[model samples]
Target chain A: MASSYSIILAILAAAAAGLVGAFALMKRTILAGDVMSHIAIPGLGLALLFAWDPLVGGGLTLFLGILIIWQLQKKTELSAEAAIGVIFASSVALGALLIHSDEALVDALFGGFKNLTPAEFAFGAGASILIIVALWLLRNKLIISLFSPELAISSGINVDRINLWYLLLFGLAILANLRFLGALLVGSLIIIPAAVSRQLTHSLGTFLTTSVIVSVLSMLIGTFIAMHYNLDTGATVVVTAAAFFVLSLFKKKR
Target chain B: MQPALTVLNIEVSFDGKNVLEDVSMELGAGESLAVIGPNGAGKTVFLRALLGMIPYRGTITWAPKTRIGYVPQKIDADRHLPVNFKNLFAAKASILKLPAADIEEVIEIVGLNNNIITTSVGHLSGGEFQRGLIAFALLGKPSVLIFDEPTASIDVAGEEQIYDLIHRLQDAQGITTIVVSHDLSFVYQYATKVLCLNRAGVCFGEPDIALTPEALEKLYGPHKYFHYFNDSHSDDHRTKNHDIQQ
Candidate 1:
């Protein structure tokens, strides 16, 4: 019964992470998250190598990802998307090379859902709550900056400052959830829920709210199904989210 | 009295090529100015430079630190962008951090009905979209308003309505206005000053004094439209009378 409870806790953690990811996707720029996830892998490998928690390594990875993107945006001709792509591909290759000899690869790639504890569940919930609060506080500036940056600037909004905060929040969200979803599928988690919700509603507020709800529900369903059927938790969760996206698309078409 | 805006020796270039060369103009508070030019004459570029959207090589000083509102030529709304009037209003409210009531006031002033505010901005007719943009611009109670061919996509009646709105806003708020347009007939009534621009800084001011037959011939250069210049003089006379009554 305790094992079953742990499984439930793991699903909740995954869902909270998924919700953060969804917010990133709704902003229409999740390439940055992708880069952070890749950079996180090497950090994870190094953490395991040094006998440290992988989440600590993931946090360092997320920070590096944001810093690198910010530096490239300032000094290079390459856009944020291009910079993220370069970082994402290179970091993934580096992580594969670094973790080749360790057993960490199995745990990192498939995720060890069995190892989730109540403390981790609390951490995940706390991170999710923090992300949501930050987004709420900056919602107006973020939405305006997204739609028409020039208009926002003209209206006396400091556009550069807003953009900096936006990138920072994006990095933190990816850092908080890198363990459950893995680097490969973290971006999909953020993008799929928002995209699916967008298909369901025309209102931006409704779309955002529905995305969060969908993310949590999918996590619960996916985790339960994974345990019952002896399936991989990460893959099951992603597949469940994808299935919901497909369903929403078909419903819109009708 | 201080002029609402003063542009002194403003020069604009794109990719090492000059678009607006050494242009200077001023508009007094409550005055209307029309920036008239042919296609590819850099009118839009000039307007953008004044708005400080583009980097330029001169000083644009405004009296009393006026809030300048802008309406761009085209607002592209793709399916990916779920922009409605509420989204636009929310964007303004967010940027300005204004109360909801202020946003509604601006919406009402722009004459947008409740039904239009709820509809998607992408699905709006040309006239409706233009009005929505005007509403958006007027939200902060701007003292200087710039419209970049607001009537270009709309019907004739729509164009007249837009001009009427412009006149009403100017009269009500005493705001300085600059309109960039190729359509001379629409602007003839409202423009206190007309600026005719071509490459190499060819311009004339004071609509009646500047739009001469010879000047029109020189600017247009062997076009069929030169004959229309003669008719424009008589139309200008009628327009002057219309402006007096308004």
Candidate 2:
């Protein structure tokens, strides 16, 4: 029953991450996920330090990380990826310094699902639904902004404001998924499923729907196999997502 | 009646270096103006200043609430992104807050076939892609249309056809047209007035009076001017293309 609760949380987190992942993949910011995931490790360390829930700790820490990256990118001459790289390296060192024990490091990297509670499961469901609905409402504007910034400006859309909001949504999805997927595997959860969907679909609508379906399936299969074989669930989910991406590559697109 | 657009002593500097200086012109309603110059001639900077995409020290006064449509020379699209004609048009239509028209109507306005809207933007032929851009510009229904090197990356025949289409569209709508072009042949054939620009306004008048051998020499310098003029260099097809028809 406890494992089932954790599984549900995993599914919700995967769904949220994979949905936004579709757009990020198109924007060529797929590596930003890897960067964010590594940086959120320090957030996990802070959660243990404060005796609060890891989700709260990680989300707040990653939020600060996002802000730093955004401001540095704007105020300095550094590129966006370069700004993220600086934060990622600093956070990794900080996370290492803060972690007390081998078990704590393992939990930070791979999430101790055994520690999850019923309340955490509920929180996962609510946050996932909220993120998905928000993305749905903003879909049209996001699509337009992603296509052409000049067209966005000419049509009266404030492109900069939309991009900031997009970054917020991206950071939120990444932090929320860091629980079950862990800081290491969460980035793959977002990228691989969306990438597989990209190869199979022609239109934007199909692209989004297919990515969600693939995310859910990968989580279900990976969790079941890992539970049965007594393997690391986080690693299994990532491997499962990779398997899907491989199958997708074989399927001819265009 | 007051002119459609008036400029007085336009100056643009980047990092304290002058890119364009003391440019002035007055364009009447429905008049077509072509801005011609060689590389580093500040043609794009001038166009950007006119579009209000950049800043300059100048008084650029337009008639009140004048709507303008701009078609860029080209857009580089990523093949990984999902961009089609209908969605692209829908984005602009939503911005305009106008009801979306049938694909056929838009294609007809821009002289394209109905089936092309579903194709990815990167896959379209050069001419068809340019028409697609013009169709998007028309979504705003502006009184003035600006083209930035419309015939670039197109074959000679394709360039001629595109210019011909522009002429027909301008006349039919009585649209005020402004084109930035390097093709002197097209300027001679279609421009009502020309502005020869190189860091400053070299000359501004009807093509016949402004584009004389002296002005050509001044724009291109003596060595390059000899090939363009003096009837010695037969290899210049644009000039030969002009001669063959005359």
DockQ in order? 0.32, 0.32
What tens digits encode model 1's per-residue C-alpha lDDT throughout A70-149? 66654435575676777788887877877866557866655646665666666665766676677778777766655556
Tens-digit lDDT track for model 2 on A75-145?
Answer: 43457667777878888889878788878888788753567767777777777877898888677677766
lDDT of 1 by residue, B1-246 (tens): 888888888888877998888788777888888887666888888887877778999888889768988876655334344457777777777667678888888877778888887765555667787888788888878998888876766766776788889888888888788898766665567888777777544665777777776666565675634554334333222222111110
Candidate 2 residue B243 Cα shift, in angstroms, is 31
What value does the lDDT take at residue A30 in candidate 2? 75
Give the Å shift of residue B11 in candidate 2: 3.8
Instruction: Check candidate 2 and list the clashing pairs.
Output: none
**Candidate number of the best lDDT:** 2
